[model samples]
Target: MDKKKPKKVFVEGAIPPEKIAQSVANHQSKTNIGAHSIFLGQVRADEIDGKTVYAIEYTAYKDMAEQVFHEIRESAFLKFDITCAHIYHSLGKVNKGELCLFVFTSSARRKIAIKATNYFVEEIKAKVPIFGKEIFEDETHQWKVNK
Candidate 1:
């Protein structure tokens, strides 16, 4: 069964802090969910060749990314006893210290929620065709890869 529909997961630029708070508020009424786990991916100021990264320009094949995201969510639902899940990823320039991706999962127990959140993060990193161009302090850039 398709327990959930394919939803828009991409956000422009940086993922705002308030978005996280709002998500919590939105689910407060879902009393069945006893535990919630959230994973926030922040752009790091990675130093390389005497330069520090100031921002990251992200891009993706949107249609394919969405399909992959949907498939991941469906698999997670089957693998975990989760009540709900949500994901948001940045599609443009995100500064160091700003959030780039957000993955939230809710379940009746701590273990399921925690594991599902980790699964979602890992799947996104491995399966999503997201590209990040690290822009350094000196305006120089380099391609980024998840390590």
Candidate 2:
């Protein structure tokens, strides 16, 4: 039942604060949307092996990742009464405290929007082929595994 075409979900570097605002502003004309839920995934400065992570360099099998993203979006649309959904992920280096992911869902009801947003975030984290290389402050890096 996935009718939508595959979308390029990856953005370069970190997702800008202005992009989020613009997304919200862009949806104002959709009068049927009563509630919107948004999730922002920020990079954390984690300490491991006595080194602190300063950034994450992200990479993915682009073609496969885009298809998976399309499937997820279509699944969300079929499962929820959401009017709109948007997902963006960062590629390349995203520094600590910067946003790496943004998920937004809108529906006629508050609960539906929130549930759809949650579903998108969960599915993306679990199913997407995106990989992150955790870059330490000292310039060393390690491949990060999602938990």
Candidate 3:
């Protein structure tokens, strides 16, 4: 019989800071890493031509999103001598200035952790099938992908 292996990285719904911290701790428990670096992306309310962004609604093609995320995890592991990595992004409505995405990478050295964090975030943004709708104070909205 083929044995199924448990997933190392978790991907789920609107991730809170507490949840992310918990996952980081869980990953760290089994890792002998000396450094952990995290990068969190937050939604910001910005005024565009007198219109103020009040909130954001996030949506994703879940199947594709998961596939993309999985690739990112594999790539990170192959590229960096890292112990573990975790990524979470919000879905549905998120208020202005709220946390949107969280990425944590731990490695035996700070240099690897830093490099991995940057590469992970960039790859996720560029490759993920996540979309965002920016809702303005006036109730108008627009869909945008991370540039």
Candidate 4:
């Protein structure tokens, strides 16, 4: 199952816009990749119990989470004819509208790339033991579950 030495997929904070752009730029050299798909997950300001969410504090059991990510990575490549894939998720508090997750997939065809990216995202959401605490505007908080 050692396809690629389980890439480091976690970023220290909210993923910066520049980093996303750089990811695209870095792939320009891959001439064989005809298409690339990207998925970005952002914190949303949702009103819950008369309070507005301001940010999300993300946490995870690092070793287990990474192992889950690794399994997902291998599964994705096995299921799709993807040329490359990348996943990044925030490790700390990320404000509303800021990026918390980034998933990229590339292939010779657009459909495969898009499909692989979506599959990776679903696997991550359903399998990863990552947790998020939604912080409301008034400092109240609640555990977040992906919906």
Candidate 5:
């Protein structure tokens, strides 16, 4: 088990581009990390039943979601020889083309970093309780179904 405390993963709104840059910058001092992989999940303006999605309103049971996220991270650490990992997911409203999720992983090798990042993304999409309501251009909305 990871002895580190769980990280706060939920952001109140769409993640800013600067935040992504800052995250990368923060890792510059970690010289042992030979490679880094990142995954960004953006809100897509999808046309559903003639209505176009313009944004997504996300909500979650915060406490439970955080616990699950911590568990996933712990499992990832045990499964991969990653030097570092981070995950940020948005809550509340996020406009189309905005970022909703950010996953970062670092390792001594390129393949390990890339595989760790992919594992985080897939596990998050399948296990997290966070829900997204896709808002249409016409002001209608539908609950998004994760694939």
Candidate 6:
């Protein structure tokens, strides 16, 4: 009998690029996929209503976040004939211009890869129970989401 490996989806406390890359490689190794799409979300120091963002502190309702992410993975699998998917989001303080979210999807063709990548990122941002506190350069802060 052939065994299937488990997929990884995490609401982590701070993830490095190397770790995410390793996870992507692991998922790719499981199938003979021909395309891979990755999206990396970075914190930016920008002005909001006259305030400049200095950094961001991320937080999540972990259990719900994980559950939502899992559903996204399942939906991606059902909607697209893909090889695998992974999502990793940081849970603590992330400095400006630092990576906070990473999404990787691989498939047998480029069409599905592109579609699934877009769908994955959109769904996660809209549905996941993750929150971000944007710190202003003047020491003020506010919670932010994809607008």
TM-score of each: 0.97, 0.97, 0.86, 0.96, 0.97, 0.86
Clashing pairs in 6: none
Model 5 lDDT per residue over 1-147, tens place: 638777899999999999999999999999999999999999999999989999999999999999999999999999999999989999999999999999999999999999999999999999989999999998999999998
How good is model 5 by TM-score? Answer: 0.97
Q: Give the Å error, residue 46, model 2.
A: 0.6
Better of 5 and 6 by lDDT: 5
Q: Which pairs, if any, clash in model 4? A: none
Decide which is better by lDDT, 2 or 4.
2
The residue-by-residue lDDT of candidate 6 on 21-89, one tens digit each, is: 687667745668888888888888888898889788888787878878877888788899888777788
Candidate 2 ranges with C-alpha deviation above 4 Å: none
User: Considering TM-score, which of the candidate structures 4 and 5 is the better prediction for this target?
Assistant: 5
Reference-based lDDT, each prediction: 0.95, 0.95, 0.79, 0.93, 0.95, 0.81
Q: What lDDT is obtained when candidate 6 is compared to the true structure? A: 0.81
Whole-model lDDT, model 3:
0.79
RMSD of each: 1.0, 1.0, 3.2, 1.0, 0.8, 3.2
lDDT of 5: 0.95
Sort by TM-score, best first. 5, 1, 2, 4, 3, 6
Candidate 6, residue 64: lDDT? 77
| Ten contiguous residues minimizing lDDT sum, candidate 2 | 1-10
lDDT of 5 at 109: 98
Better of 2 and 6 by lDDT: 2
User: C-alpha displacement of 103 in model 4, angstroms?
Assistant: 0.0
Give candidate 3 regions above 4 Å deviation: 1-14
Off by over 4 Å in 1: none
